[model samples]
Target chain A: MFSMTIIAILMVVVMFVGLYLKSSPVLQEKSFWQLLSSSEWKPMKGEFGFLPFVAGTLWVTLISILIALPVSLLTAVYITEYAKPYIKRLVFPILDILAALPSVIFGVWGVLVIVPWISQHVAPHFMDFSTGYTVFAAGIVLGVMVIPLLVSLFIEVFSSVSTDLRECSLSLGATRWQTVRKVIFRQTFSGIIAATVLAVSRAMGETIAVLMVCGCVIGIPTGILDPCYPIPALIANNYGEMLSMPMYEAALMFAALILFVVVLFFNLLSRIILYRLEKRLG
Target chain B: MRISKSKKISEEIAKVCMCLAMLIVFGFVFSVLWTIFSKGMKAMSWDMVSKLPGGGFYIGKEGGFLNAIVGSLYIVGASTLIGLLISIPVVFFLNVYLKKGSKVAYLARLAFDVLFGVPSIVYGAFGFTIMIFFGLRTSLLGGIIVITLLIIPIFIRTMDEATRNFPRDILDASFALGATRLETLKVVLRQIAPGIATATLLSVGRAIGDAASVMFTAGYTDSIPTSLSQPAATLPLAVFFQLQSPIPEVVDRAYAAALVLTVIVLALSITGRFITNRFSKNKV
Candidate 1:
């Protein structure tokens, strides 16, 4: 039995080992700081700077979380505080189905629906909007994807708030708005923060859906309307041809390593916050 | 009167804000499903699942995605089975064999959390590098290995939560009877059987829908693989490659493929719910 647990833990080590071995050459050949600081990412030209992709990743994640946060918070509060019992039952299944819907379908939807709609109606108003595939479009798609996760996590937090607290506030003549803002939100602040961290980590490493609509360009996008590649998209778009150039595969492997570390860091941070929050709540 | 009116106004504002947010999400979900079904219905046919792709399939020539459907089944089925085989024992060890709050147990739990959050694309990258180092190519075996790794965290955590819900008095009862830890495990396993089922199903839903991790590891093919050495095509990959084509027919087929994937995932999730409910009666 102990052996089984040990073997399962060893699985993570195997993945890290594979990443380390694959990315080692790139780390040695190109200085880590140069790779992190430079913007040039032409694989065929042997330039493997990843700074732009990092910027693109942070840009999209920031935009997505910004768009998603208010909506998720509101939806969660509405469900917990305002929704009737039968309404909650009706809403749960939709959320579950939405959560299970594949990202590729989201990609398809983004390409067919969001892309054209943005290009025709929304993009032309901007000064330099080039195509349908913009960081903003990808961010919106990611916002849709991340909303369910945040809402669900927030629902857990909201549901776990003690009824006694709500009653105390209400008996003191607090309005629904006042009770939620003053009591429920304050009680679940740490959990809400943790959910935000986890959701951003999710948007950061998202690949296929983001890849489909990110336009696959390698550059520091000047604006949300410009096409650009996030780190995962850079990897997904180029891994097929990475073998075509010397160290190209290793460079992409290093990109993957960077993605791994960034996501891992956020996940760990979220877990720590969640642990502390649980301790407090308990 | 002014303060009371102001509070009422604020409450109404909050209500409107939440309603708008819910409406936006509802619209998003509605449009995505409507598009897939409308397009998928047009392109879907009986032969799409019953036959393999033929010549010039890329150009909307004759053929079907039978290969991908079968290959997805094989890979997801095998990997889910293996993930269960490993996951059940690990969960049992954690809950029954180890002391509560032990470092090993904490580390194991934390490891699975990070693993669950690790992106599928990284798994693809890791799997590709492993293949290179081993002097191997993308094959069905590679897909199974990577996918098994991909879902291990999910498998472990679901079962861990389920096993955590196991009653301590039951364990104490068994041990008081002079039962060995191994025997106590059998009793506990029976207690969480439904969770084991739910975990396996949830992981299956996830494994079948994921494409990024399998993109590099499971080399695409037009036919069902005859052995572990052969590469397999998956539904998500099929949808991806087909959707990129300029042809309308191929693009429609991609929607049809997406519909297929969505249906499979929905069915699995519903099944998971039923099993979870079934076990809720036994929950301690």
Candidate 2:
């Protein structure tokens, strides 16, 4: 039993070591900073710059969090604090279905609906002759994808606020809204931050839906409407054909390593915050 | 009186905003489902499931995604079995053998949490690395290995949660009866059978829908794989590759494929809930 537990814990270390070993070829050729900061991504020319992809990832994650946070928070609040009992039952199935839907299916939906809508309606308002496959399109689709997750997490966080405090606030001449804002929000503030951090991490690593809509181009997107490629898309789109160049395989592995590390960091941070929150609340 | 009136108005505004947000969320869900169902129904055909891709399949000619269907079943089935085998033991170890709140258990849980958060793409890349080291090409075996790794954390975590909720008195009761640890494990397993079922269903749902991890490792094929060494196609990959075609028929077929995947996932979720509710009544 102890050995089994050790094996489970060792999985994380094994992943990091294996990825680093595979990525060492590229890391040996260029410093980590150079690889990240440079914008050149000519694989054939052996220049692998990750700046554009990283920037694109950040842009999509930011846009998604921006769109998802408020909607999910408000919706969760409505369901938990305002709605009738039957409403919770109604809302939960929707969240479950959305959560169960595959990313590729979401990609197909984005391609058929969101892309065209953006190309005709939203993108033209911002830029000239957009193909609708831009960071913004990916962001919007990704935003929708993350909404169920955020809403679920937010619901959990909101519910964790004790009813006694809510009663205390209400009995002190506060309205329902006032109690929610002051007592509930105050109690769950760190929990909300942790949920957003976790969602941001999720949005960062999402591939297929974002890859389909994000244009998969190599340039840095200066605006949301511009076509851009993210790191996960870059790795996914290139790795199959990367055999001809040894460094290319290593470079893609390095990209994977980057995602693994960053996601691991965020997960760790959120876990720490959540653990502290749990301890405090207990 | 003026202050009270202002507060009332503010409350009304907040409620209105919350309702609007809910409306937007529901709107998106319905639109997505409607699009997939409408497009999928248009392209649904008998050939789509019964036969493999024939000549000129990608050009909207005579071919279906039987290859992907069988391949997905093959991969997901094998991986789930392997995942269950490994996950059951680890979860038992966590909840049964170790003291509650032990540092090792906490670290293991934390590790699984991080692993769960890691994207499928990274797993693909790591799997690819392993394949290269082993001099293995893309094949069904590669896909199974990678997917098993991908889902172990999910299985362990879900079951761990269930195992943690297990009543301590049950273990004490078995111990007082002079039952061995292995014998007592049976009781606990019986207690968490619903949890195991839920975990398996959720992991299978995730593993089947995944495209990126299997993209490089599984290696799509035109026909269903007859051996572990052979490349296999998956429905998600089918949707991905078919949607990229310029032909409208092919693109419609992508929606058809998406619809198929959605139905399978929704079915799994429904049955999972049903099974949990059914079995949970027997739990202590």
Candidate 3:
């Protein structure tokens, strides 16, 4: 009975907090709107706008997903449908350990190695730009960070396709590629899309690595080679310097709300897609 | 026969490519491990582990990470234990007592989902705001609260999975023997105790590696925490500080600290896997 009451109270608290944050007068005020719309993000002057940060986040997330999704899907397909057992055993654990590496190390590596290499070589050759810290660089690093997740998810989805399906396709004189494309891809389309969305969300929420590489500039990035500030980076950069009570509270609330929504949407979507896939596959 | 030859060629190429991909992945992992080990091992002597970080910039000469190490242990230990205590019971209540398709269960699951996705930084902000408002700023207790909140969702989801995976026949057999509901739970459900413990250990792995959540809430202090109310530095915080410093020694110390943190997480993961394997074998 006590446990039930506690669960009930916790449930009520969750809804209450969610609703209050959604409907708070502080969030709805004209000043809050003005603050959110303005492009200036000076904490000392108490000017805060989320526009550039949000745009940066969207741009980086889009770029990272574009890079990660294709490579990961191809890698997954190759491993699941084409690779031998010995190769699969060797490859899968490597990906797992890569996924488990701490984000801080990634951040340090980005700062020390990736940024310099890009500045010296890649950026200069590609865009005639000599800078290391750019949206493109950060997005690439983010792609690397999220690749393991996408690979693992797609591998699971692909491997779930029945051996009988593959055998039947092969028996009909279809090539391995044809079997994968005709059978496995068609079957796991929804799961793949869900995994892509989940990967996008992970890239969006990434903080330390992006902060190290993204240069943290507060403006719309006109080119992929330009620097930009992501939402999480902005929050990490400004939280300590926020002087006004309202500004600080509002920034925290806004960052929390944005993160909450992005993460929640992907989590629910992934869960739903996986549930449907499980039901159908089982 | 022609088709088989062509198929063999393509299969061989694909296998080669897969092998190369795996090599690339391992190459990245080994590069990272080498970087950390080469720099970290040189600095991580017994004296370094036993002393505290000095106020000055000298790393090898002045002080060590004794306080941060102890504080990490204290904070992660306390928070993970508390989180497991609360979450296991809640997971049990939801999985066992609540009927399927019940409104309460639905809401409970929803709450868990939301909590799981909530950013660790937001938890840090919330804990910071609440603790400051309650005059508990920069305190170990504040850090514990924040870490506990961060781990709760993880523990709940893990324990929930473990419970759902528990065999129903065991429960039925106990009940068939005329055991009470609680007694049946103790006998049948408790048989999966090691699995549940493994889940909680995974939670600890997550908590120990977390940096952003504890950054604001913990409010780093160089000194050892003598009381729950005192502020303390964790290994992550120490690493962060060292990374930000201009001194070479300090940077090396940061690498050492990172290595320590990584080893701890690796150890936890291995132990969790061992326990899980042992549990599965026992069940079989």
True contacts kept of each: 0.66, 0.74, 0.16
Error of 2 at B234 (Å): 0.5
- Models ranked on lDDT: 2, 1, 3
Model 2 residue runs over 4 Å out of place are B1-3
Candidate 3 per-residue C-alpha lDDT over B1-284 given as tens digits, one digit per residue, 9 for 90 to 100: 25777776776675666566555556666766677777778877776788877666454458888888999999999998888778766777776666655677666665676566556666666676667668886788989998988888778777776777677777678778998767766864566688688778778887887777787777788788999999878887777667877778888888888888778877777677668766777762
Candidate maximizing DockQ: 2
DockQ winner between candidates 2 and 3: 2
Top candidate (TM-score): 2
Shift of residue B260 alpha carbon in model 1, Å: 0.9
What CA RMSD would candidate 3 show?
3.4
Q: After superposition, how far is residue A65 of candidate 2 from its true place, in Å?
A: 0.6
Q: What tens-digit string does per-residue lDDT give for candidate 2 at A1-282?
A: 678778878889999999999899999999999999999988889999999999999999999999999999999999889999889767877877788888998898899899999999987777679999988889989999999988988887788777788888887888788888988889988989988999999999999988898998889899988888988999899877898888999999999999999999999888778767766765
Mark the 10 consecutive residues where model 3 chain A has the least summed lDDT: A15-24
Per-model lDDT:
0.87, 0.90, 0.74
lDDT of 2: 0.90
How high is each candidate's TM-score? 0.96, 0.97, 0.88
lDDT of 1 by residue, A35-64 (tens): 999987677677888888999998889889
Task: Report the Cα lDDT for residue A101, model 3.
Answer: 62
Summing lDDT over every window of 10 consecutive residues in candidate 1 chain A, give the lowest-scoring window. Answer: A273-282
Cα deviation at A231, candidate 1, in Å, is 1.0
iRMSD, all candidates: 1.7, 1.5, 3.9
Evaluated on the second chain alone, the candidates' TM-scores are 0.95, 0.96, 0.90
Instruction: Provide DockQ values for all models, in the order shown.
Output: 0.68, 0.73, 0.34
